[model samples]
Structure formats: C-alpha cells, structure tokens
Target: MDVDGRNSTIGYGASASGMTDFSRTDAERANPGHDTRQSFQGDGMRGRVLAIALTLATLIGALPVAGSLWVAWGSANRARTDMLDGAVHEMLARYNRMSTEIDQVFDDLSSLPLAEACEPVGLMRLRTAAYFSRGVREVAVIENGRILCTGAGKSDMPASLPLPDMSEGDVRIWYDRVPPDVRAPASDVARSTVIARNGFALFLDTEQIYDLVLTDPRTVLSMVSLTSRQVMGVRSRPERAMLSDMVDRFRTDPPPRSLRVGNRLIVAAPTADGAAMALAAQPIDVVLEAWRQQAVPLGLLGLTSGAIIFWLILTLARRGDTMGARIRRGLARGEFRVVYQPIVRLSDGACLGGEALVRWQQRDGTMISPDRFIPVAEAEGLIERLTDQIIEHVFADIGKFLAERPTVWIAINLSAPDVESDRVRGRLDRLRKTHGVAADQIVLEATERTLIDARRAQSSMRSFRDAGYRLTIDDFGTGYSSLAYLATLPVDGLKLDKTFVDSIGSGTPADDVMGHILSLAATLGLDVAAEGIEHGAQADYLIARGVTYGQGWLFARAMEAETFGAYVDGRMAVAGPPSRRRRA
Candidate 1:
C-alpha cells in the first residue's frame, strides 16, 4: 500500500480506535518499508508526548522557584531594615547614656562650694588642681581674657598668661592645626578652661559647665575660652592631638546633631560653657563589606529561595488572585484635629486664651496621642503643614470666642525645628494678616531647646517682638539654659515646667527649688504661668506667689469649644489669696 493510501485508511479508523494496526502479512513480508513506517510513526507520537510532559514539568517547577525568589528578596530587605534600625537604636542608647554620665559629672562639680573653688588665694587653684590632678592634664583659672594660674606640667607659662588677641575662628584653627609640640599627649591631655560669668560674678555653682579637651580615654582635661579665643592650658602631645581633632570636629558638626561619614560617626554638643565640643566613634562596616566576604553563599541561597517564591506568586496571580495593598497615608486628609487647652488667670480664673493642642483621629476611630505622632511628623517634614493647620484652627477658634467675649490672647506651642526656621516668622506674619489678628493676640511658646542657637533665637525673638507678637518660654525650668536664656532672649512670659508644679507643696527639697524659680521669674519682671496645676493648694500657693496665669485640671480640664464658650460666659470664679493671684 502507498503511504497516502495507508494514511487515508488509518485516518478513518484512528478517530474511533485511537490506534493503528497492520494486518497485511504478504505486503509486510514483501517490503520492510511497512515496519519502518510504523516505527517512525511510533517515535513521532512518543516525542510529542515527551515534549508536552517536559513543558508541563518546567511550568510546575517554575512556580515554586519564582515564589522562593520573591520570599528571599523580601527577607533580604527586611534584614537590612532591621540592621539599620538596630544601629540607630544602639546609637541613641549610647548617646543617652553618655548624656546621663555628663549630667552626673556636672552635678558633682556643681555641688562643690564656689567659695572653695574660687578662693582669692592660691588655695582655690591648689584645690582645683588637687581635685582633677590625678587624671588632669592641666588646670587654669581664666578671668577677663587672662589666665591667672596654670597647673600645666610645662614651663611655657609666664607669671600671668595674657590671652592673645585672636578671633574664635583663628584660635580654633591654631588649636586644631598646630604641631604636637604645642598639643598634649594621651597621658597628659591638654584642655582649654574658661570661667563663664553671669552678670558680675562667675556662675560656677549653678550646674555651670566648662569646656574641656580630653583624650579618647577621657583622661586629660584641657580648657579653652571661646570668648577670649585662646587656650588656657596645655598637656601631653597625644592627648592634645585627640583633643584638637575632637574640638575641630565639634566646631564643624556638633552634638545632638549627628553626621555620618563613611564608617565613622561624629557628634558635637555645646558645653554648658560657651565652647562647642565633639566626640567621634567608628563603627565597623559589616553591612557594606558583607557582600564581598560572605554574601555569595547567602545570596545564592536567597536567590534560589526567591526564585521559588516568584514562581509561586506568578502561578497564583495567573490563577486569579486577590491581594490587598496596605499603606500609611499620614495626617494629610484631616486626620489631625485640634483640642484647645485654656490658659486662665490664677486669681480670677478668667480664661485669657486657649492653647491649640493637636489630636490625631485614626480611621478606626482611635485617637493617637500627640506625643507619638508629632515627633514622627516633624521628622517626616509634615510639621510645616501640621503647624499651618493648627494656626488656622486656633485663629478660627479665636474668632468664634472673640465674637462672644473680649479679645483674648492665644498661645501656640511650636516645635524647636519650626521655631528655628526663618520661614516660621513669615508664616506667622501671613497667618496674622489672613486672620486680621494682631501679633499680640497670638503668643508663640518655644522651649529653651528651641533657642539653642542664641544668635538665631535672639534674632527670631526680636522679629516676633517687633512684629508685636508675645513670646513665651515654654516649660521654663526643665531646660538647661533657662535662666541664661531668659537674660538673653526677648520673651514676654515664662511657662513653668509641669515637673515643678507637680512637685509643689510635696514638702520635698524640690519645693524649695520651685519656690526659688517662682521668685526668680518674679524678680526678672517676666509674667509667670504655672502649668499643670492640679491641686487647690498648689494653685493657691502659686497665686499667692504672684503667678499671673495657671493651666491644668485644677480649675478646669481642656474642654470642647461649646463647653469652653459656656464656661467663659459663666465666668467661673476662683477664690484665692490676692498675693498668689496677682496679675502682671
């Protein structure tokens, strides 16, 4: 039979039998062509079946391979995030621990009697030297651009060391770049010392901090006068080198503010004294070099796993999958709202103005505390928007309140970052204009930390004052630079920190401290507002002490606008001693 004829015959039976059978024995015997044709047909069928099986097997394997790959990629990303978070947390912990240590050291130094530390005779010098001599590289008494005496081991000192007429920048350059001959060693580290003056007397006993240059081990302490722009004393070469490097780095990038450079971290913070000091630490670059050293094996494993994951996901997606996307959209869509806390006169309980507090309401109807999100918002650059929204709400609330009552001043708390920005002043100006409100009607409450840069703070405060806005130093007693800041900054009012009020009349030594603070504010001729006043006795005590304003749950808790309006209409009266409630 011919090939075409045979195929035509087989085609008819192939549909029903799903097979082909050769029954012509004579033809098979005459030609081996029949067997060859049958063999070729059998091979073709097997090949097709093998191809289909291989393709299906490949797809099945790819699903798990893709899934594994995706999982691996996610794991790698998560690991990196965890590592970075751990590093930041560790750094913060170390920074806090160092701060505590410094505080303890300052406390010890402050506890010493000033009379003993600054005796007219050399006894004070001897005592100072003796106190720090064991680990001290040098000790010098600096007063009015002159070094009175030195405990430096070198013979380079004159009877009286008159400071060189150099600018602060010049001094820093000289100190940082000078040869080791002038610098101190690790064993006898050189430090620059200066006495900070408060009015006429040196403020030594009041937790006053002095600038010191020390070795990496923190052994040798040197003092410098930033005002005088000169080194007061010297010590060993190795110590001086380390101290100079530290001082230079500090001048460039100071503490609380951290800058990362390659594998090293440099941090600088201002001394209780005027000088800026810095510390540097180098962390091993394990993450960056991980790929070259150990990443091949890990990456191969991750890649294989990731491939499996990718395939699994692709299969699931192909099978018609449903997935949800979760994202955190911040306070952009009216998630943040304002709550008003009334600031009232302690004597009459007359509500002067309400401070606008921000509250975040989540989609789930849960209210997130300001303490949690405010910092995050600030970090995320959402503070500017947040501030604007707050100002708008405050002004609107003020407008409503003013329609019913006489003009009242509203104080709004600003973050240090916001207050420090030049744009803040402009924003405030615009807000004032938009609301048709006078600057006096709105008080900006900034903490001492907000005024870290004295020059900038002075400039900003002056601008606010010139614009006719009231500025209050918020949480006054809690800051390190409160008293010194009050003397310098242009502020109209002082808001006593809550800690002081909470501790009042507890019959503890802290009460005496609080009383002194109240007296101090009164002496300064600044208006005082006792914040967080909870008890009647505390309120009465504060009122007697001439605190003009008070806030907290003592008189009334923070209420809604309607409730506050009613309270104001009723003019809730507070009975107290006239002395305590005296208005400024």
Candidate 2:
C-alpha cells in the first residue's frame, strides 16, 4: 500500500502487545510450516556473481600493463642492439681506412726498405712513406733488439721490443706499446700499436683502431683481439673483469654478438679482417629508459580499459538484480500466494469482510517480502501483470465463499499504474461475470499517493464506482490528505494509515492529526476503517469516534483462503440473526 505494499491494507499484522501470540498461534493453527518456508537463498548466487565480475575486471585491467612491460623490455633490447650496430659500423669504417693506409705504407717502403737499411736512401723512403700514410705515425727499420733507422732521422737508440700481443701468420702486432717520446707524461701520451714484418715496423696510435664519438657518454668502446681474447684499445675505462667476461663470452667458435653482464649490456662485432672485435658496453638503464617511454601510455590504456569493463559488468549485474527479471521468474513458477486479513465492525467485533494481500514464497520456501519486490514491479511496468495475478488468485481462492456470503466484501490494494489504466476494470468485470460474484463485494483500495494526478484518479474512481464496485482511499493521512483533496475524489470510505492509528494514545502531535483526519472523513460523509488496531483501548477510541470498520491482530492476523473462510463462517454464526447492511 505504501509504494512497496509494506503497509498494504491486507498484509500480516505488525508486532504489538498481542500480535506475537496471535501471529504464532494463527499461523500454526491455520497452516503449519507456512511461516518457515520463505527465504532469501538467491542472495548467495548474486554475491558470487558480483565477486567474480570484480576479479575479472581487475585481471582485465592488469593485462595491458603486463603486455606493456613485455613490449618495453623488447624495445630496450632493440635499443641496445642498435647501439651495438652503430658502434660496430663506426669501428669497421675506421679499421678499413687504417688497413688501406697500412697497405699503402707497406707498398711505398717495399721498393728499397730492406737493402738500404740505415742509409740516406732508406731514411728518405721511410719519411716519404710516413708522409703518404695517414694512420702511420712512424716508419722504421728494426732488426733483433736494434733500431736501424726512423722516418724522421737515423735511430741510434736500442729497439726495446717485447713479445707481440698477437701474431697472425707472418705479421706481429704490439698493442699499447710505449711511445718514443719519454719526456711526455704517460697519461698525456697516446698509446701506440706496432705492426712488424721482415725488418720493418709501422707505428700507429692505438686510438686509430677504435676512434669512437658516442652520443651516450655511458657507453664504452674497446677493441679486442679475436685470437688472444685480449683487450687492445679502449675509448673509455671500464672494469677489467667485465671486459674479461665479455671477451670470454664472445670468444666462442662463432661468438655471441651481445650479452648482459651484471648491470651492463655488452655488444660485440668482429672486424672485416677478423683480427679485432669491437665491444660496446653500456649500463642496463639505457634499456629501462626505452621501457619507460613506452610504458606510461600502455599502462593508462590498460587501466582505462579495465575500469570501463568493470563498470559495464557492474551495471549489467545490477540491472539483472533489480529489473524485475527474477520477479517474473518467480511468478511463472507459481511462487506467489494470496492471504486475507479480517476487517471487522468496531461496534460489535463482527467480521464483515477482509482485505486480500499477496505474498511471494519462493520455490525454496523462502518468502520474499512484498516491500522488497512491489516497487520493483511498479518501476519495471509490470504492476499490471502483478495485479492481474493477485485478482486471479483472489477469485480462485475464495470466489464461491464470497458468493454465499454476499454482505462480506474483500478490499484489494491497487498501485498508481492500476488507477491509470482500464485493465483492472475489464479483468474485474470478466471475473465477476464468471464467478457470479457481486461487483460491490470486491472493494478496490488506492492509497492517497496514487491520486497525485487528481483529475485522472477522480475519473478512474468514478468509472469503478459506476460499475457497482466499492472504492476506498487507503492509507489516509500519509500522503495528500487535505479536506480539499479528499472531497474531489469519488470514494465510498477512507482507511486510516497505521501511523495515525498507532498514535491514538501516544500523546504525540500525530495523535492530534488523527482527530483532524477523522473529522475530515466524517465531514466528507465517508465511512472510516481504522487499519492496525491491536489494543482494546485503540478499538474503544475508534468506536467512540464513530470509526465503523477496523482491522489488525486484535481480531486476527492474515490467513490462508480456507482459514479466512472458516473465520468468516464462525463469525457469521456467532453474530446470529439477519441484519442487512452495506459493505464498509
């Protein structure tokens, strides 16, 4: 009656002084195990579905970040490979030029170098060869431990030479050999490389092997001997152990081109002649930098996608929960039942009629309260179907009983949508004709809230009244209940809301309002039915105030069709004699 049928004119009685005893005894006496049969078992299934949706959303959101991380790692590796390839390209270019220059120097000195030895002609040829070659710093003649001649002038000093660092067939190469200028500081002087064959040697700076200019200062470039695994020339100082490890790893039969050592990445490329290897070393942070650049957008995209998916699932789940889908299923399964609460005359306690209330007991025996599903039915536009079902249940349960007892009437609560349509009237007409029940015996009750659009409700109430049906404004004093508002509607009676009735002796301001409501109903010449009357004092007060009809636990709680019929029959017998009266 109150939006969700919680305060429907015809539902089970609320707890008062005597309702506890009445509810238990009436339920057990009328239909055993009926009260214990209803539950909210579907809640567990709904909870699990929600939990699963949340977990899936979380996983879905994290997937993109995971994929991004993988992509970032790949990007970092590619960057390292590019750096290695660039370093290798530069080293190969310089090696090619140095090799070409050395060949030219050898050719220039080949004509007269060995025979002339320390002579003027040999010295002149050496100076000319040194001048023609860009890589060669000096062209000299050496034999055993003695320097015979030099490109600049005759060399009288002893040739201090050690075993060659690497030997390729007839050629011997000295890496980082001491320079001839002893006056220069060791740090200031560039280390030299000496390549000797026969009685001749070409003096070249070790830097010429790998003269690198890298964009990343953290990068280190070194030239390593492929055969001996020796680091020959380095552009930057790196740890000796790391260099050794790199050499050991790259010294395989076909050597690895790249590898990671500790926090550094090492890349190697063999020179064209295969005599030297270009090694590029850099910290792992370079790879991380690449990863960072790519991770931010991917992570955001993943998070965004995850959030959207979660919202969609949650929306769908909530819709499934509240869209009255389950209510429809419950209806199809015949989970709904109809019960009646007696409405008696306050003066004699005579059971004149009763109000029909709908109860939904699921297949599992769990009862879904009308308060939980009635508003959902209205919101989903399924109130008409629910009303039709209740009407059918009412007639099916007590049609013949009502026919035999013509004076007793049953009030059925209606929703706002029901008042707005002619469907209820049509259904009522068909049922009344089919069952031979008088239209006046079935009263239609609408709460004051249903008449928000006064003109429409006035017309609908008038139509029902014209069809010989009793119409009452139920749950009065709870909504629009001003004298002006009530006077405009066509209704046979006014049903006082439980709030005002409960305030009868509470000494609250609402108690005063109840008097005003009774006065208004009397002034409008409408019969009054007090709902939720439990105590004797309340009934005495209503009777004294001229409230003709009253219903609550003081009389009887809502009961099944058979029990209600039995109660009516017993009351009729006790009342005796025939006293013709109009339905209240």
Candidate 3:
C-alpha cells in the first residue's frame, strides 16, 4: 500500500471478528513505521523524571532557609530566657543586700544597752544605728504596733502603726508606711517599707528593694509576699491580672522558674527566707522582635543556597517588611546623616557650640522623621547602632572644627540602652582619640528616662565625668522626674524641654514649674540651657533668669555641617567675644 493510503486507514475497526480492533498493533501494523506505545511510554517517563528532578531541587533549596529560620527562632527564645534570668538574678542580689542590711541593723540594735528607748541614751544609740544603716531611714521602738520612740527622738504622741501587710511568726512587714514626724513631703514618706520584730522596727526605703536594672526596659520587676500574696514592692506598673496570677502561682512557694503567662514571659525566684518572691515580666512580642533581629543576618546567609525565585521573593518582602528592617538596611547603606543646632550664649548670641542631631534620608530622597524611626530603633534594640552611626557621622562632619575651637562643644544624645551599656562610651573614647577631639568638647546628653536604674546610671555618668567628659540631661521635666531628681544623676547641665519653653509666659501651671526649675538650677549651680527659645521675649526671660546657653529657631535652626561652620564663622566675625565687643 502507498504511505498516504496506509496513514489514512490507520486504526480502522471491523476485522474478521466484526469488532473494533482498538489495539496499538493495529495502528502500528497499518502504518508499519514507528512503535506508538513505546513513544507514549518514553514521553511519560521523561515527564516523570523531570518532575522528580524539580522536586528534589526544591527540597535541596529549601533546607538551608528552613534551618536558618529554626536556628534563629531557637536563639531568640534562648535570649529571652537569658534576659529574664538576668533580671531575676539582679532582683535576688537586691533582695540579698536588703536582707543583709536588715540583719545587720537588727543585730546592732539588739546589742545596744538600752533601759528606756524613749530616754536620751537609748535615743542616741538608735540614732547612731540609723546613721550607719544604708537602707534604714529610721529606727524605732514599737510596742503593740504603737511607736514609742524613734531615732529622731521621743514621739510627742503615741502613733499607732497600721496593721502589717505581711506577718510571718515574729516578723512583720508593712509594704507602705508613713510614720510620725516624717517632716519630708508626703510623696517622699509614702514609699517607706517597715520591717518590725522583737520590739523594734526599721523603716526601709522601698527603692532599696525594687530598684532593679532590668535587661529589657519593658520588663517589670516586683517583690511579692508569697504567703500574703501581696506585692511588697514593684518597679514599674504591672498588669493587674498578671500580678494576681503571679502571686497565685507562688502561694505555695514554688522554686525558681521561667514560664509563659498569657502574653508575658515571667521568670520568678523566691527569697531565701521563702517569705517573698521576685518576678520579672516581659512581653512575648518583645521576644519575637529579638527573633526578627537575629533572623536578618541568618536569613541572608541562608538565602545564598536558596532558589533564585525564593531569593527574589525574600528580598522584595524584606525591603518593606518593617521599619526596623528598613533602618538596618539604611544603616548598612549609609543613609543616616547628622545636622547641628547651634547653642549660643543668650547674652551675646555668639555660638559657643552646637548639638549633633541625627537625621535619616533614604536613597530615594525621602526623609524619615526622628520621631518616627527612633522609637522603632529603640524597640528593636538597634538604638546603639544608630548612636554609633550618629557618632561616626558627627566626628567626620565636624571633628576638625571642634579641635580648633576649644570653647565650642558639641552635645550628642545617648539613648537609655546606650547609657546602660559601655559600648557607646568606648566608641566615643576611641573616636575622640582618633580625631584629636577633647573629652570636654563633646558633651554626652541623656534623658530622664535614661535613669532607669538610678544607681547604675549614676555610676555610668560618674565614669564619664571621671574621664573628663561632660554630661547633660536632655528634655528635662518631660518625664516622671522633678528638679530634685537631677541631684541623683552626675550631670553638669540640663536642656529644658521644649514644652517648658513653649509654656514660657503662658501664665499656665507649667510657668510656675519653669520658675521652680530655674530656681533649683541656680541653687544647685547647674548650667541651664533653655530649648525652643523662638522669641526675643522668651530668650530675654531665660537670659534674665541666668540661662547662659540656649538653642532654638531664634538663633538658627539645625543646619548641615558646612552651613554650621560658616554660621559660626559669620557670627564670630560680627559679634566677636563678649569681652572684645564690650571693649570695642
């Protein structure tokens, strides 16, 4: 048969059996050319092989990324646990100090030869004991919960003590107390924790018990009485339900443990005496944030082995995932820059120095406000990196200028975590040494909130001052602090908050506070710098009140390093020194 006729008649039905012959042989026989079944099987086998190859490739590509994510998550969880453990350890150390002091005071008081506690000799001995005790504010002799006499003197009247908050055998504890003859302000006297036993009571400061340096700022520390389920002392405000649950868990004096309660991770340890417990609580989201921070580098490292498609998707997703991620990327790309706001003498308007303020600008020429990104950086524990970048940029921008002008000082803001850590101080010292910048020429500024642990903050600032670096409190009066709180911090100057300056001459209650702040600064002999002084009247008011330094729009807004250098040059050319101008 011809090839065309055979092809046309292929797979035809109705053979001798009068049934359709649907076999592949019929087609193959009619054509007498290729094997149709073999061709079909070969194509199917090729498809199966290709699918298996793709599947294997996908699994191989995903393994690394999956491993990275697992490792990152594990590290984050371990970090959270470690942080909680640290906080608990710190609280226990505090408790140990307090308990040791209590034991010492009780022993000293017990050894005193006292016939009558209300008499002159006994009062003198009590006073001497109180003088030596660090935690004891007052030592008193009590009878049936009534104060008979104290180190201050004999009570004019018998003052009845309130019922104890925690009573265990012979020991009694009052969580909050205000005894008679506490002449200090009501606020100061309200936080006293009284521990009484064997006819004597020691009025202890609650701060001694609860002032802990928590690893995470959001972590809350508290001392709770396991028996009474009452909070003996607390550092920051805690959720009501969380506190209640925590107290309930320790009713039977459980051993030290870390457990998740609702949305918080709580690490708790009991006091040595088993009467009280210390707990540190942090949010779960904070832990997840820590995970995200660790995941960035890990994920990048893993993506090298991932499929090109996955790499592309991850890159695009991370590009806009979070502000923290954006900041991290921005820092890597050198998108952060510095600007200087001139600090001038209120008397002559001659620039004495400038404050280094950090600014962020993306590659696309988009400006991100400090108010927006700063909090994100803080929350993500990237503030130290941001501060490092700011410091580097500052020195690069104006290090030589500062070296030439001995009188000019540039103030740099320090975040709370920076104040808590030694990294920033070390970085600053190295930069100063490298750039020939005088320690005094660069002022380190910390806000009131930076004093999270007042004792530690004081020690940190003292180290700075000892190194000859000046310290200033920025944004004063904006936090939960008063002028008196300044005495606790080792600082040379304070920048009045803009809100206080804006309320200048507004005849509001804040005006009164401003007056009080000025008076307090003057009394303390602290250098006062008024911020946001936009009006002559405001400047005049501050200058008249003896504010020597001021920075605001009245003199000039923040400018780039080049502009600021020219600004100071022009100011010096016109105004000269106050002494020189007066002589002229």
Candidate 4:
C-alpha cells in the first residue's frame, strides 16, 4: 500500500494471504512460515481520547498563564488594596500630625491681642508667633487693608495673587501666588485668621499636601475641594477644574464608584474633613496584558477539537463491520494485513522506525478504513483480538529484518480497551517471546485515553513501560483530558496529531497553538514525533522547533511492509559504514 491508498507488489502473499512483509530476509523465503495467518477489520474512537488531549493542552497553557496571572493579579490586587489603605491612613495621620504641630501657632496667633493699628509691638508679637510655629514661612499683620510690619520687614504682598476675603473657619487655606516660578509650576499656601477686619497669616509648604496623597510610586493621587472647586497637588489647573466637576457630579450620584480615565482606574475616597476628595489612579492594562499572554492558544483548542471529532464521527458513521464475532472470523481468514509508515528522524532524515497501520481489504472490494471499524471492535470487545492479529502479522512481516538489524523498531497501536482489559499485554508478551524480538525492538502505541484508563489497566500499560518498550500518546493535542494522564501515565513519547503539523507556517490561527503544544511537550521531557507533514516548509519548521521524528508524505508515504523494509535497508546501507564505524 502506498500513501495514495494504492496497492503495490511487494514481498509475498500478493493474492493468497494479503500479508505483505514489512521487512524480509532471503533465508526466511526458503522456510515454510510458522503460521499461515489471517484477516481482520477495525474502526475507531471512543473513551474521548482526543477530548482528553485537548483538555490537557488547555490546562498546560492555562497553568503558567493562570498561575502567573493569578499571582500577578492577586499580587497587584493586594498591592493596590494595601496602597489605598495606606494612602488613607497616612492622609489622616498627616491631618492629625499637622493639627497637633500647628495648634499652638493657631492659638498664639488668635490670642496675641490686636496690637494697636500697625503698632511696632505688632511686629514683636508676629516674631514671637513665627518663632513658635516653624511650619510658618512668614508672619504678617494686616490692619485696615494695609500690610503692617512682618517677620521679614515692611511687607509688599503681591496684589495680583491677593488672599481671598476670609470668613469663619477653624483653619483656612489660601494660595500665595507671589513671585511664581514658571519652570517649577509650584504655589505656596497661607493659613490665616481675621480679627475685626485685620488678620494674621501663617504660610506652610504645599508639597506636604502632595506627599500626603500620592502614597505609591505606581499611582497618582489628587485632592479636590468641593466648596472652592480647587485641587491641590494635581498637575494642571484645567485638570484640577475637570476633577472638581467630576467630584461634584460623583458626590451627587456616587454609585459605580470607579471610573476609567484613559487606561487608568480612577477611584475616589472622601477625606476626613468632608470638604475634599482623595482620588487614586492606577493602570488597568497591567492585569489585562497578563491575561492576554496566557490566552494566546485558547481559541485553537475549540476549533481544532471540533474539526477532529466531526471528521471522526463522519468517518465512524459510514457502513462497516464493528462486531467482535465478525472481526474474529475476519482475523482467521487473513483479510487484514499491515502497512508501514516510515518514521524519519528530523535531524538527519534517517529511518528511525515505522508505525504499523492495519488495512482491511474486504472480499467484496469495499476497503474498510481503520476509522470505519476500530471503534466498533472496542465497543464490541474485539479490540484485543484485532490487536493480536495486528501485532502478530506486523512482527511476522518485519520479524526477519529485525532479527538481522536489531536496532530497528516497529510501533503498533493499542487502545484504552486493550490496556484496561490486559489482553494486549498477554498477546504482546507471548508474541515477542515467540518471535525472539527484544522488548526494545517494538513500540506500543496508545492514546491518552489508555493512560487515563491505565490506572485500571496499570498492570498492562505499566508492563509495556517497565519492560523497555517505548509507549507513546497517539494523536496528541486533539482532545481535552490528557493533563492528568501525562503526570501519572507511564508513557515515553508524544505523537503530534497531523492537524498541528498541517498548520505549520500557514500563518493560520493554529500556529500559536502548535508552538505552545511543542513547548509543552518539551517541558514535559518527552520526545515528539510530528504526523502529517507534507511540505518542505512544514518539515523545516518542525525540525527547527525541536521535533525528534516525523511521518508523512514529506518523506515517504505509508507503504507495504516489504516496501518499507527495502527503504530502511537502503538507508542503512548508505549510512552503514559510518554508523558501524561510530558503533565500533
């Protein structure tokens, strides 16, 4: 059989028994065959193997993403929570700390008694107050709108930025916009009290306000005055005015407490004085980027899985024999024979091995594909028998070649039913012993479904692993449940489904998913064999990305066992001297 599903003349049984040797030596031709065997039919898919494969892929992509994300998110949330709480706590602490520090100054200014209209003693009292309240930049006496003597001498207050008319308030805040620095954009504030149209003012640092609000380096904060429509510690005057309007609107209707201001999360917390608001702003994209990184392959899982199952279901729906009794009879008549697809090592294109695929050439001339019959065998309790026939015929065809070139291997597929029932192990042990083939000379293939069911058939799947046979997950990344299977299953390698190999370098949506699958397989320390590679570019991509082996039309298609043997023998002859020298 060739890749086009065409028949070919190979080694023996071209008509009598449908068996074509995978590998044959001339000496075996002279001897009568040990057993003249058989015919069989099979189709596939149950136990949700593909579904489990996908579940595992998603979980792999999700874990680092989810873990990094959850940790980053949870850490960010915790940091935000702590900073907001700290900002509030420090805001109140400053209010109290300043209150205690300035209380004596406020009392002294209020009680110093009105020094008679610009009296020199007024200057003396101003000096005394300034000395007591170091927070005060200057002390001033204002009598009937005339600036009296102050702590620094005759006063000339900037008339343009004059203090607003004061009224009754315990502690008043007003900006002294005198001698502004254009480069710095900073302003000073004066705290004052009035006595009978005359007042004494004390100046304080405005940066103290800036420090009180902006608590964390990653965030910005602003305090807006509801009564005056003024904002302190904000960057621009217009921004202050805009924030004032927002704060005013918010106070009237304060539901939906947080607002977005250009990628930043703006949250408002009212101050202790009830006269102002404290707004904290942080970017939301920090968490969004984290989620996006992990979600790169999320869409591929659904699209690929649907395509796989839909094709399988459509294939399974076709008319074919699925019963055990029929398969038993078919096995006896030799209706089934083995075809081999050469597994090529990506590094050097060497023939690593071949996977044995069963093809049923029914007597009526209707060829039943494996997809049409394997599932029915499993559901009908005939998978074990089908496997037995496949194993026996595959080794029979390849037996003599393997005996000569002991290093060469052949892989055969087994299912969950084969593993769960222990029938596969018994047959393999007996056959390998009879053929005198080392355990390493044969590879046992199973889907993730087998490993997941392996717990039940532990003795079977484990026996394959323990006895040195390479066990692989067939059609990997096609389903959603193999995550747990990877950790617990005693498998040795992963066979990437054709879908991933097909999408290689197409710039298709599945590209990222394929990269992720390859990365995950590597991370698990499993060697990967890519299936369905049909293009040079695809082969190049998989090889560059660390694929160990590949099987597809890109190399040679599935062929009769005899053709595969010839191919392998030829390759070996070409590389034989150097290989032998290296071994020597």
How would you order the candidates by lDDT, starting with the best? Answer: 2, 3, 4, 1
CA RMSD, predictions in order = 25.4, 40.1, 23.6, 28.2
| Candidate that scores best on lDDT | 2
Q: Please identify model 1 stretches exceeding 4 Å from their true place.
A: 1-279, 282-304, 307-328, 421-436, 507-512, 572-584
Instruction: List the pairs of residues colliding in candidate 3.
Output: none
Clashing pairs in 2: 1-5, 37-365, 38-365, 38-366, 38-367, 39-366, 39-367
User: Deviation in angstroms for 245 in model 2?
Assistant: 74
- Which tens-of-lDDT digit does each residue in 342-399 have in candidate 4? 8878778888678887776656544554433455565566666777788888778988
* lDDT of predicted model 4: 0.57
Regions more than 4 Å wrong, model 2: 1-323, 573-584
Model 3 error, position 187 (Å) = 21
My TM-score estimates for the predictions, one after another, are 0.54, 0.49, 0.57, 0.44
Candidate 3 per-residue lDDT over residues 210-318, each given as its tens digit: 6655566888878777777787777876787887877767555355467788999888888777777888889999889988998887777666654764555444433
Instruction: Give the Cα error of residue 378 in candidate 3, in Å.
Output: 2.1
Model 4, stretches more than 4 Å misplaced?
A: 1-325, 457-459, 482-484, 507-509, 573-584
